[model samples]
Target chain A: DVKVTQSSRYLVKRTGEKVFLECVQDMDHENMFWYRQDPGLGLRLIYFSYDVKMKEKGDIPEGYSVSREKKERFSLILESASTNQTSMYLCASSRVLGGNSPLHFGNGTRLTVT
Target chain B: AQTVTQSQPEMSVQEAETVTLSCTYDTSESDYYLFWYKQPPSRQMILVIRQEAYKQQNATENRFSVNFQKAAKSFSLKISDSQLGDAAMYFCAYRKGSGGGADGLTFGKGTHLIIQP
Candidate 1:
């Protein structure tokens, strides 16, 4: 079985504060993704990393950035937290793209910005 | 760009009954992959079933199966003998084949499944 672990299951931050969400995968997958899930809108990709030090912007990448210093860990950074940034964040990893590989997702972190 | 659509936002079914969740996608490419992912109250996304465009046969995982209509570009999920544990948010997703530049899955808004007692 593949295990994806997120650093925090729940978090709260004040407006204008910076926040970090960490994720680690035991499968050593090459692809890691960060997504924010909101009610009615479903899950939207924020950022993704294909390899160490390589990152790409997804559909919704405005106030967020990501870091992949190592193969097993991926971190999502919120430059300036706002009330609108409060939502459930999910991290997923896959062996490689363009194959039959399916993404294994973490439990998710629900962040609240006040 | 590819887009997935799930028209039904919410659906309900009684125990021991069957329910179908509809999904439609628009893509210019001929080869791609379709998936049905379930997110329960625990907020963990689980792959329920997956279908390849090249294969005519529908994908099935035990009580979970997909009705894939290639030409119509529709893929719907059918859950048989619904249980309380089946209540969750079901998302429809589309992914292009190996040769495409886009590697990630494009997901729909999702349908919330409610199981009645």
Candidate 2:
């Protein structure tokens, strides 16, 4: 079984403050992703990393960035937290293509920005 | 571009009964993958089942099964013997079969399932 762990299960930050969300996977998957889930909108990709030091912007990348310094770790950074940024954030990891592997997700971190 | 849609926002099923959730998608690609994910109140997303577009046979896992209609571009999930633990938010997702350089998944507005005792 693949295990994905998030650094924080819940977080609260003030407006204009910077915030960080961390994710780690034990399976050493090559692909890691950060997504924000909202009501009626579902999960929208914020950023993804294919390999160490390689990152790509997803559909919704504004005000957010990601870091992948190691194969097992991925981090999401919120440049400036705002009330609108309050939502549930999810992290997922999967093996590279050619294999029929689905993403394994961590218990999401619910962020609250005041 | 690919898009996934779940028409039903909420569904109710009695324990030990069966319920089906509808999902439709639009994409020009001939080969892709479809998935149904269940997120419980704990906020952990779990893969319920998956179906490959190229395969004509529907995919099934234990009490969960999928009705895949390629011609209609429809993929529906059927849950038999619904239990209290089956109550969750179900999401339908689509992704282009590998080789596209870490392609991201497109997801639909999830349907909330409720199990009535």
Candidate 3:
């Protein structure tokens, strides 16, 4: 079984603070993704990386950035956290983006900005 | 750009019964993949079933099966003899054929399933 690990399960931060949400996958999957989950909007893609040091903006990428320093690790950075930035963040990894390659997700990190 | 829609925001079904969740999508590409993902309450999200556009045969996994209508661009999930554990938020997603570029899954708003005992 593939395991994706998120560094924090729950986090609380103040407004205007910089927040870092870390994710690491044990499997050497080449593709990684970050998503934000809300009540009615579902999960929206924030950022995705196909390779190390390569990242692409998703539908909602404003105020967010990503870094992939290693194959197993992908990080999501919130430049300036705000009350609106508080949401459930999910990290997923896939072997490759073809065929029936389903994404394996880690336990999401719930961030609360006050 | 592709868009997935789950019209039913919430559904209720009795245990040991059958329930179907509807999903519709719009895309210009001929070849792509569709998926149904389940996210249990306060739990991690997991893939439920997947269907390839080329294959005419519907995809099934255990009690979970999909009704894929290519012409209608509709994909619905049917769960037979549903159990309490089946209660969760189910999302329908679409992904373009893999070749290059950002191949992230385009997900719908999701349908919340409730199992009544």
What's the C-alpha lDDT at position B35 in model 2? 93
Q: Give, for candidate 3 chain A, the lowest lDDT window spanning 10 residues.
A: A95-104
Residues A1-114 of candidate 2: C-alpha lDDT, one tens digit per residue: 999999999999999998999999999799999999999999999989989999989899999989899999999999999899999999999986423468899999999999
True contacts kept of each: 0.51, 0.51, 0.56
Candidate 2, which segments miss by more than 4 Å at Cα? none
What tens-digit string does per-residue lDDT give for candidate 1 at A15-83? 999899999999989999998999888889998899999998888899998999999999999999999
Model 2 CA lDDT for position B41: 97
Global lDDT of model 2? 0.92
Among the candidates, what TM-score does chain A have in each? 0.97, 0.96, 0.98
Better of 1 and 2 by lDDT: 1
lDDT of 1 at B9: 97
- Local distance difference test, each candidate: 0.93, 0.92, 0.94
Candidate 3 residue lDDT tens string, B1-117: 788999999999999999999999999888899999999986599999999999999999999999999999999999999999999999999988865767758899999999999
Off by over 4 Å in 1: B98-102
**What local lDDT does model 1 show for residue B58?**
93
Q: Residue B13, candidate 2: how far off, in angstroms?
A: 0.6
| C-alpha RMSD for every candidate | 1.1, 1.2, 1.0
